[model samples]
Target: MARTEFPAKATHAQTRAHNASLVLRALYDLGPISRAAIARLTGLTRTSVGELVAELEQDGLAQEVGRGPSTGGKAPTLVSLIDDARHMVTLDLGERTFTAALLNLRGEIQRRATRNLDGADGDAAVALVHDLIDELLAGPHSPILGIGVGTPGIVDSEGTIRWAVNLSWTDLPLGKRLAAHYNLPTVVANDSRAAAFATFLFEGEDRPTNLIAIKVGHGIGAGLVLDGQLFDGDGFGAGEIGHIVIEPDGAPCHCGRFGCLETVASVPAILRRAFFQAAESGVRIPQSIEAIAAAAAAGDELALGVVRAAGRALGMAVASLTGALDVRRIVVLGSATVLGEPWFEAIRDEARRRTLATLARDTEVVNGGPADDAVLLGTCALLLTRELGLTVRR
Candidate 1:
């Protein structure tokens, strides 16, 4: 009788993929390096490095650049990554608008497109997404690697939008739908988490091992990068500090929660307070964040008070986050950052007052600075990490 043969998992194929990613990462990060250097860095055999490099070269993803200085031996040939070898279509599904961009391997935007929601929801919003992607793909560009979508919602690991109040999306299989339609890889992530990864990855080579980037805009949320990896928590809602209750009897949040942090700290919350306070005081109503910020800068008492209250609410959230996680580097970004020093000072002071002295003293909460396109760039970062293994850790 013939011996029974149990099928084995393709361990060799998995190993090859892992090694290929390693090689690609090396070329992307430390290009103009020799195969020997890559082998040394990646701990692979020289033969394996040569074979992988050949594969990369054949794919037009890398090429021999020049020769490097000899080190007591023959001069070594250097290879470099072809940055534009493959393009990525990334989307930022914001509260009021959807932005898409064509990006290269280096996360640089080559082209961009936008679609205003105009109160579109359900299938209409999805159609807008499709239209934007179609328009982007119908142009001159390199071979596409994949699509990445940074959407505002509680997205699961499978890229299903669990819920998005603004877009009125729920239980949508967006990732699978996109991949099936486009016949390419696709990744969908929470916009806040994506922005946090962008901040961490774009920190150049000196990024912290752990960081928490809170996005305070039309909505309030946070993304936590712990130990050089994005932490999605058990329910994929790790950094959802927005829905956390701050005031038991405060305003209602879109999430159906009363007195949630989002009700007090988000841009809309701040604007609502500013409007009511200004109305009560018979002052001119500020209709935009820019105007409100200007008033705060000019020491308008009403604007300053609203900024302080909003910042303090956010500060309470920060204190809870830092006290629980002990992460020292906090980056506050998004539209609310325009409120400037008064808002930031209030946040810092409140955080310091609320947290333990030792922890508070070491923590640094700073602005992320003009991150209007953070969501778009963040999607690019996600695609690079997932498709090419060019992780943010260096």
Candidate 2:
């Protein structure tokens, strides 16, 4: 006999909840929207939209802001998001440091703090994050809605960090632990992906849809936002391009790989090369990327060589991505890109030379600078989306 398939429980109820979330998000994005306008935008029945809006208003996620002009009869009262209804805490966990912030409903940071962590041990990291949140909440603020964390690695669907070589984390239940500590809705996402979302929140209006955001720092990673949505693969590690092998046996990487892009294109990689060259030539090597950039700006051949070599590696990686993803715009963020236009020009020239004519013609490369607040901002967005139920479809 054939195996019997069980029907999904309360499909209609889940659908309604999802649709209600859509309605709320629509109002949040396009504020002061009329019920009729929401119905027209979301394609839900007028009655369904009305019911959802009433429910949202009752929940204090939304409110009637003002009246809208009517074409025929009585003007309708406009509805918008209650920007001060609640708050969220966002944690930006990087390989070297962590930044925490409290964001309000309008996605504005109310309070922020930064600290450097020794390593990415799950327990120690959690303790540090909890203490930071406690300190931030001690200030004058409203009730918190939830917490969001952005880390570097492959985050599973259940929020388990599969692997973060930079942080030395593996199979860590970060999301569960944070939620348990705060007893609030929590979310964990890839740092690059979060950065992509933050970029969209900050500059989506000016950028194109088929865009590639390359984050070059201690580690080299890319975040692809296609069709205005963060794209993650089945393993939730779509943009783990840092580990992509540029040379089969180049330099050793933390991921136990050789010649990965990060091993050659990251800030540390450039510093290592500089130090090696300086040692061989009996010259003092610059200590940091900033110092190196300063030296290069002063016509230091050694500094220029370091920057140019890393730029070539980065350009090759970008060229590969441009060919594969066929993205038109590439936004590079981190210390290396800020090393001045020479480094960027090297990468851009190589990419244009190697990429197809059509791809090169369409591509526009620009430096995004160091995303000092991107991670925190993205974490805030994650919490806001959960608490207020805002999403792209809505």
Candidate 3:
């Protein structure tokens, strides 16, 4: 028997929508540009561009900026996107707090609000999210376009949080719940994946579409963007690297494992080691990542040694990524990045030592230095693409 197949087709509306998005993209990337320039760039008919521009103007998304210099004829009027035509609400659910913000179309923060979770679990934590959103919405803003959420743990593409140990959530339909209660478009994604997308979108132009962003806070995970698209893997665990065992005989992890990357490379790991070292040296234990960073900055040999060890652990993961994926761009984010230059040097050194000479030579391991709002902006990016068919440009 022959294999069954179905023919694919696009309806007239679908074609028009796709073309409209193309026109918008051209205007966003190259405007203040003339209609003729947009037509030339997008390969759409001049008539079609005119109609689309008029529609966009009527919808308050695009407007004429000014006239361009004459090209041996009459000067052309330029049009540009109304960067604030729409607003999106974004949230980042962190270990100790939940932060929310109002953002413009360009992913610029308009206003922000936060609430401390304080180890709140179950219903209380969920309510805290609602409280933050309500507070932001109650501010001087109306007609919100949608909502975006960045959280920890496994998140299905359908926006279900399969499991978040810290948040006390399991198989929670957070996306659906938010959308229904607020009656707005909602998107949810893992924090690392969202950070990866944010790095890919905002890292400037003429760059490769593939990049990896590793979030090393209390946990360590990575997000991969391949060919300008987020690859969630078959099980939605594409970037779940924190739990991978690096030292099988080392200390036990909370996930019931021994010597996982999270046990050595994460912020908690560094702090734990710092405390132990302090106990041995009869020195006061540093209480936070910031304090340890400050100590390292003051040339504390003990603190620097602990940071170097953690950085080396992280570099092992980088070597794995470079050797396997050969992705040249690796961005490290979260509070752990505050360990500063010494930590970064150790990471780069180990990654180069472990990977192929040529691959390591071309790889650029960038420290993003605690992009606190990356999750919010990344979910906003995801929302703009999935809901509005638009790419965010700064």
Candidate 4:
């Protein structure tokens, strides 16, 4: 069959709108560029760029800077996104705590607040998020674009929480509820996916086209980016690696599964194992990972063993993931990965030994900093993607 090339038809209005969006996005990303420069970058005519800038200025989304460097004639005024024009509510809902931040268009968090959830159910958690959003919005800020939530679960396209084992949630319409409350667009995403988005936004400048981000925290989850885009599967739950069965009759997972990766490598799992080991040894174990890490740092053999075992388990999972995806880069985020060099070395060693030589040779596993704010930044990134019209809800 011969491939046919259709001639392009120009729709003036649509083209202009698209050009305006392109110009705005350019300025949003690379601030303070001249109109001529924007036209060159976006492939829009100078007149179109100017008109779009004017519209953005009128809409309060953009403003003019002083003047650009002189190039033979009168210097042109530089345009940039108005940082205070609009705000976004970024929420990171963890199993034990709910964190909320008010962010500007530049993804800067202006105010942050966190509260512990007394209950462990979806409704109570959602209500707490609603209250937090309300509190943040009620404070000093312009009209908010909407609320973006990062949680641990299978999030559907319509922002339904399909399953969140930690919160004991399933089939909850989170986006719809938030949108109904605020009469604005709302986005909800898996916490790991959200962290991956944040990592991409902040540290993906040198990352490969295909990347896998594994987030190890109280629970483990992953985000996969292939061809420079997040690869959410048909169920919008592509990277639920935490629940992948590593052992058929291993430790029980909150997801009602045995020997899941999360059951073996998550913070809670590690601590639980450490506690059991200490109890068996007749030693009083601390209740927090911090204490364990401190003990390990102080040359406690038991603590070191517990951490190394967790690292090995995580590495085994990573080996499986690399074999399946063969991504060029694997970014590990969370407290466990940040445990100095001992844990990282163990993970690297196991991964290199188990994964194929071809896969292991080129795959770069790096500890991703900014793990603490990854979810919040990812929530803001989700809103930014929506505002830039890069994604559409089905």
TM-score of every candidate relative to the true structure? 0.95, 0.87, 0.93, 0.92
List runs of model 4 lying over 4 Å from the truth.
1-12, 389-394
Query: What tens-digit string does per-residue lDDT give for candidate 4 at 147-260?
Result: 899989899989999988778788999899889978988999999998887776666446567778899888888898888787898888888888888889898877887999
Better of 2 and 4 by lDDT: 4
Q: List the residue pairs that clash in candidate 1.
A: none
State the weakest 10-residue window (summed lDDT) of model 1: 385-394
Candidates in order: C-alpha RMSD to true structure:
2.5, 3.2, 2.5, 3.9
lDDT of 3 at 262: 93
Over the stretch 1-394, how does candidate 3's per-residue lDDT look in tens digits? 9996644454667778888988888877788999999999989999999999999899888999989999999999999988888889999998888999999888999999999888898889889989989988888874678999998989998889998877889899999999999999999999999989998888887657789999989888899999989989998989898988999998998778899999998887899999999999999999999999999999999999999999999999999988989899999998898889989999999999999999999999999879898899999999889876888865
> Against the hidden true structure, what lDDT does model 1 obtain?
0.90
Compared with the true structure, model 4 gives a TM-score of: 0.92
Q: What lDDT does the true structure give each of the candidates?
A: 0.90, 0.81, 0.90, 0.83
Cα lDDT tens digits, model 1, 183-284, are: 989999999999998898878667789999999898887999999899999988889888999999999878887999989988888889989998999989
Give the Å shift of residue 58 in candidate 3.
2.3
Residues 1-394 of candidate 2 have per-residue lDDT tens digits of: 9997656767778889889888978887898899999999999999999999999888787889789998899998899887777888888887778888888777777888777887655667767778888888788877788888888888976678988766667898988887887788888888888877777667745656667788888887778788977788777878788988988979888788899999888999999999999899999868988998999889899988888888888888888888988887788887676688879888888888888888888787888889777777776776666666664211
Clashing pairs in 3: none
Best by TM-score: 1
Superposed model 3: Cα runs more than 4 Å off: 1-10
Worst 10 residues of 3 by lDDT: 4-13
In model 2, how large is the Cα lDDT of residue 282?
96
